[model samples]
Target: MTPLAIPAHERHGIRVFAAALSPEEMQRDKAGLVAALFGDPDLDPAHVELFDTADLAGVGLAGYLAEGLGVSDAALAPDRARLEAVRGPVLILHSRALHGRAVTLIPDPRLTLLAGYTEERPPVHFEPLPSDAAKGSLTAPGPSAPAPRLPRRALALGAALLLAGLAALVLAWR
Candidate 1:
């Protein structure tokens, strides 16, 4: 029995079967399917798959899509294999930005197209610190200066005063 056109809501679960269909055949099929569902002629051929919904869903269509679309499996093979081995839902995304138009097998649809583009701005200027702040207060203190030494002359004067005071006291006692 011929399969009915897949519903839009069910498109997520529907498995696309794509192969070496001639360019002409691909155009024709693409046109018909696009008219029925998206009503747009810009359907991405890379998004198409070749397995039935059940098999694709069962085998994790994301990995199959990535491999079939000539996407690099080297980076994603291990994780893809693990997901396929577990038989879980898969979502694959193809973009020129990532792996160069290669199909990337993303096991979680949430993970696909997570990164978005935005115009970047130039770096902002930072204000310099104000001057006049105490260097020791503003910055950590370094080694302190050594303690002051007493002058030799001052020491000699102190000794003379002590001797004179003792001599005066002895004379007063006499």
Candidate 2:
């Protein structure tokens, strides 16, 4: 299994959102992994969003790849299982490249696990994606996805009105 090579054109929008799964877990979790890459494999690539990795954050098979690796650095080692795990969920956004062709990665010593295929990259900031099904209250909201502010004054007024109504009822009963 070769290291999964994201093509030159496709790498820009490829961001692993740092919410439900940590940056560490995103490299490994199955649901988070699959959702981030292939995007609900049932759908075609054009309409599919590339990095919505939050969907499978808490699945039963989520951490199968990360299992037994032990420590973050050790998980970074490039191997057959690592390559297989990486390739399994990744989608080919461009075409239906047929089987039996050997895929080659342009070997660069500088490339690390987080290092993407491209050189000049757009800012991949921590923007909170809307994932009520995924993070819920477990993680902090991303910059783009702020949590809804509570309507404090409305609640207070409602409570006050209820109390007044109760008092009037008590007086009428007396």
lDDT of each: 0.39, 0.36
TM-score between candidate 1 and the true structure:
0.23
Give residue 41's lDDT in candidate 1 (0 to 100): 38
Q: Which consecutive 10 residues in model 1 have the weakest lDDT in total?
A: 109-118
Return the TM-score for each candidate structure.
0.23, 0.18
What is the Cα-based TM-score of model 2?
Answer: 0.18
Quote the positional error of residue 29 for candidate 2 in Å.
25
lDDT by residue for model 1 (87-160), tens: 32222222221223222232211222211111222468977557756333555789999999889999999999
Spell out the clash pairs found in candidate 1: 16-49, 16-50, 17-49, 17-50, 18-49, 18-50
Off by over 4 Å in 2: 1-49, 60-98, 107-174
